[model samples]
Target: MIILPQSIAHVQQLIQPGENYYLVGGAVRDALLNKCNNDLDIICPGGTQKIARRLADQTSGAFYILDKERNTSRVIINESNGDRIVFDFTQLRGGSLEADLRERDFTINAMAVNLTDPVHVIDPLKGGRDLLEKWLRPCSGSSFRDDPLRVIRAIRYSVALDLKMESSTIQELKETVVNLDQISKERKRDEFFKILGRGKTSVSVQLLHSFGILPFLGIENLTNFAKVLQRLRVLDSFMSYLGNDSSLLKRDYFQLASFISGLGKQRKNLSNYLAQPNNSYRTRKDLDHLGAFLWDTSHVDECEVFKKLALSNDESTHLYILLKNRNWLHEFVENGGVLDNRIIFQYFKRLGDAGLDLALLTLADTASVVTAELNHDLWLLELEVCGRLIETWFEHPEVVDPKMLLSGTDLLIEFGLTPGPLIGQLLENLREEQAAGEVLTRQEALDWVEEKKLK
Candidate 1:
């Protein structure tokens, strides 16, 4: 393979022939491991931002200083194929790349592949060795302590890349992991979601449980999380969707809560955890919707937590509203109203996904509490049914909303009746009948109204 550099080329060309410029940190780590590399953070000797900025300007890229304290500037260049190429230039390395490489968090991320003149590596930190070994070893324990978010990053890397944490590093992380509180919540959220978006949020969920680090971040009781993962084998897949698929995430929110809350051992904590983010009061409403669905089904005690989580909202009102949204329950109800074309189209427009997801969520939630009835793979069956419902829903809009048929003018002229209350009522009824597929033509609609003996 040709050791080439679209990234390093820029750095090497800008700096003098034998000058000190090295492709350092994450780019080097990913390159050595043969991972797709585009974002490049270079550890230049000193007095190089001018050179870096000039290169970025020549390439018509954008450059901005991230932090003046760190003297780090980010250059964003767009590739011909519309891919983003980011370059990070920092002056903290003094004149030696080793000084900068050692400051990184993990061994795999601390490797520096030199780009100046003759191509060589300055792995004073052995980051390539650790990368080859599939190890998540920190450059130094105190290195991560300088930035506690790295503690979370370590856990994220383990799940995201399917790499194991070196035993010594895991022990080191636990020792200093508690200091993560020193990091801001926004930073914590950033690092946490990085793992989440990597399609490994569920695995990270499990890893957080294995180590005692999760409790420090406020998820002290993980019994529900642990059980939920085991019961619904697709727990990881479901969590994975949260990263890339927002529709599935929003659709599954209720079910995820219901399933986790169903664990039944310590019902309260799990419910609180679900509702404990972004506008707590309204978030509780989302959870209450899930709670009401499971309240009758499972013996999980969530009323008190619901009260604490909620801020003076009507609980029953919420229950009714959520039930209304979930018209799928109407499928199993005594009278679910007719499942005609009009109603199907209305459902399709209101919710992009079919009623099958709701049914599956409920089943999954029930199985989460106790695997007696839903232990089998019924989700596949639900998927097939939902596929048909979704197709029929999108096909027709007028089928769901009957008022599309006609108005008082059309009815009054056809029946030779004046535009009175009776005319309006008769026209609406005709629309309803048409919506229900009971009337096919204007003559048929008029005949039905006459049969009903409307004035």
Candidate 2:
């Protein structure tokens, strides 16, 4: 009777006054950890469904039945006490605390605390030790064998909590990592991104590499996980810009890779625009940008590899342009070699994050190939740049202009040239210049473009 919520007087009324109630699972685990806990699974001494039905009747809660063979049912009560509370009604643990703990995933997750005063803790498995040591170990490898997703979960938690998985558990992962496909992609995606969102995506990726677990997914052929960590702060900050704040970097890789890929498509398209269809120069130029990304890394720079990695036409084009134009030291010197919000946002607006990702990877690549003696100041500058980029995307989304102030038609008529594509490019560049505060109005833009064309 005590298990019934205060609002459900009717359910409490229906109870002939003899049932006992106790808390269970994650709620208790969080309580034990002194972490904020919201899950409210409850164990009822008798007729779990009847308790559920009565509660549902009183509170509009839904009743769900589970494992009819086990005669178990769940009463889902969702209460909005300024926060969501799910009262999961279940039959008492089928066996002793030890047996109940044995049925769970990891040892640390198995422990639960009673909400009753004195806050009695139930630890039939040695979960307390694991939690204290910040270690992750499954109740048994058989549990993981039954459900292989736990393998990734361990890796994910290790990255998230900045902890490590126990040796025995790592062995279990190695055995199960290849069989991960048995699990649903939706589930795998969920787990994979959870690691990413933790700002430990690179860590999880690296571990995946270390254990040879990534080949299971087509996105393997990754170089290093530790490198991802080294690049984490910079990558995350830039991704945050675009109002797509994410710990997991969960946007479609193709969408992002397209944004990042610059050199190859740039040459193909750029050459076509320049009326240089016969020249192989653009292709070599594209390879050179890949070389920029690879210049400081160990791997031999290959143009095909860049093509494979590119996510989109735009990304390929821009990356190609920026790589060939890079004079980071020159840009750094002009800006006093100290990174700030204006500098970061300017780069983000000009190059987008993919180019910056390459910039970040360059540092890591250099260390792997050359020296670990990084300029700490450069690292701070990178992080500051990341924060600035993130802040700008959130603050200002790129809205479409109502109408362009100038046009290619105007350029063609005024300048006495054929109505060619460069006119459009000229107008677009003018708009960008105006947008960037380099010019203020159509008159100023026209004057600037007219002067440039006459040259």
Candidate 3:
């Protein structure tokens, strides 16, 4: 049932008689599995850049030289619907194509299909059989030793594709797990985020934990492992239903199901909130899982841990605020406090947009502690606090982010004051006043600041 993708056929027509070009790696494997793969990997023995440039010109795609040392180039064809088709052209390693396939990381990724003759596959490592058998195997004995990052990729591919690693592969991964620290933080971070980007985050993370990969990433000592698993499940379910996809919800997760269903119409708001991208490849949902994973009932230096993972400052800051205030909303509800515009304003004031993510995280944390008996009243209280806060964030935008009624210059000029910390403090207080519905106009804002200065 091997069906070549349309992109492959398109490239086949452009192939000249003498060109020694072949489609290799995941693109070939995905084609054999009848999957839709937009990223294609093509190998050229000597003239990778020339072939890449020619393909880019023929297809009217943008071109970039990815690695000059290895002679790797990329062609990106931007589709009308905002999707991109990527073709990576790399210089084939080893002397011949079979040697090149043998040098790859895994059997499943070592297959190739010549562009000139697109019908037959060149699986030198019996990758086609492994694909049929629904198991993972290394292309060679030294696969993991060559690049320890493959250890993480092995777990990711297993969980993502529902394939089991062979017994010997598992043994080798455990032996070389320590060497993962030698890989660059950026590379490890990239592969880890790819795992997060795929769904079933809890399953993937547990596998990483079992395979002893989380320690190197600085997230191994997660407090209360069982409860952490529950929190992850609840968080994943929230991301799913809120993002308008309910397939991730499981039947055993009654509390999560009920909690999400209780959000009612605010589900759409949370969906849009969680859909915000941290970068080109990551979204707020990914951060939610990271928060759930690193969250400790006690305390841990989350910023330092994120630094160890080489996460971007923006991501680290968001997760820091998330874990720091993980219990704020829950304690508020437990202490019999009701949510209002003023409280909501202060919450967002402290956490900014992360306040919404915190609300979801708190909800998941709260749901994880409850049992099957399900205290109806307690669940209701937590839901009301979380739902109303989320509702205000999306329904009443002015409450979370109020328009500035007065500027710093207005304070310095109108009040005849120096531009010190007082001006900044007064401006911040003015925003709180605006959110509280106390200052409605520029004149009112000015008078409010004047009145505050006198105090």
Candidate 4:
């Protein structure tokens, strides 16, 4: 039986009476699995643009032609409740709906249902059966060769949906995995990030490595793959806590019950904290996974293999910062350093909000190696350090990014200093002092600057 989401059913009402439209691809597979998907893919034998344009006009959605040569277009509708619905319209690839389904990437994704007769699933490739069996199979023998990126996508589906790869499909994937180099870097990055965004990133990374895919993505050293996986698994655990999924927590994870209890009240705060986007395209959690994966890789930003991923400057910088300072908090705890306003101020001064990112990275990295009996003391110390940093970031705003006690303009006007680097130096000193509480009021700031000037 084919199931249609209410949004897709509603979209069916917008198409003109006589046009033949088939709801295809992931939308069909998700519907069968009783999953919710706001994005829908529709295909027609001809005149896809006409149908797409009319639908956009009727729904007042923004329209754009995705691929003019293929007659593929898209309509994006913004609902009142802040939910987004995306519809992609394309002409059937081989002039017939059956032929089109046969040309898709995976069996589970190749199924379709005709909108006019939504009850009948048009599965020419037995995709629905594969879905029921929890197996990921190719639509045809050349599925991966036709689009090498599907190799990564197949693994993503497996990890995200808990589907086992069919034996033959796995063999074909191994044979075609090398051709993934022929695919563009941006496309590869998109697929890889999707895997990271999914929950079971450790499993995803392990599969990518076993399938001979990590080398193409610039991961060379398997010596640390075990360590990387451990760190990523720990990172996933933290992510589960941040996402409020306590059930996924393992029994042995009870060892860290004290740390989790400490964060109990700030769960929502931590959730909102990591939910923030690093750029227009990627979130802090996305980088969190990247940081874990590259935990041991040195000079991450300078590596050419990583350069091929074509990450944004902000993303690359964030990853670089996370990896570079992954051990700072650990070392601090090991040294028995105190968590004070001065350190917190300097921490955010160097890392900004990424101080929290570093805190999470350090905790996960530490947790990866913490045995049930070993390093318990160090682990508790690190947790105390991280908890203080996180609490200051969420609860005490002034301690992190304190109000500027003295500005460049203030220095120029007050001390008759010219506009140059000294003014900047003075302002920096004042900010540090103010955040440390050594300089509280404007008069105290002036006196501190005056003392420094006299020196």
Q: What overall lDDT goes with each candidate model?
A: 0.55, 0.52, 0.81, 0.82
Q: What lDDT does model 4 reach? A: 0.82
Clash count of each predicted structure: 3, 15, 0, 0
Clashing pairs in model 4, backbone N/Cα/C closer than 3 A:
none
Please give the distance, in angstroms, between residue 266's alpha carbon in candidate 2 and its true position after superposition: 32
Per-residue lDDT of 262-328 in model 1, one digit per residue for the tens?
3333234333333343332234323332332233322223333233223334543444334445435
Report the C-alpha lDDT of model 4 over 1-455, residue by residue, as the tens digit.
56687777556886677877899999998988898888899987686777778778887888999988888999888778756789998888886888898899988888888898888888888988988889898888888899999999988998788899868888888899989989988889988988884688888899898888998887776556778888887778778877987644773364357558757767798887787755454678887888778888766556555587888878777778887887788778888899899889989989988888898888888778646644877877888878888999988878888788777888888989898888888888788787788888999999998999999
Off by over 4 Å in 4: 1-3, 50-62, 77-80, 278-280
Considering only N, C-alpha and C atoms within 3 Å, which residue pairs clash in candidate 1?
342-399, 342-400, 343-400
User: What's the distance in Å from true for residue 274, model 1?
Assistant: 22
Candidate 2 to truth, TM: 0.49
Per-candidate TM-score against the hidden true structure: 0.60, 0.49, 0.88, 0.92
Best by lDDT: 4
Predicted structure with the largest TM-score when compared to the true one: 4
The candidate with the higher lDDT, 2 or 4, is 4
lDDT of 2: 0.52
On TM-score, the stronger of 3 and 4 is 4
Please tell me which model should have the higher TM-score, number 2 or number 3.
Answer: 3
Deviation of model 1 at 271, angstroms: 30
Q: What is the lDDT of candidate 3?
A: 0.81
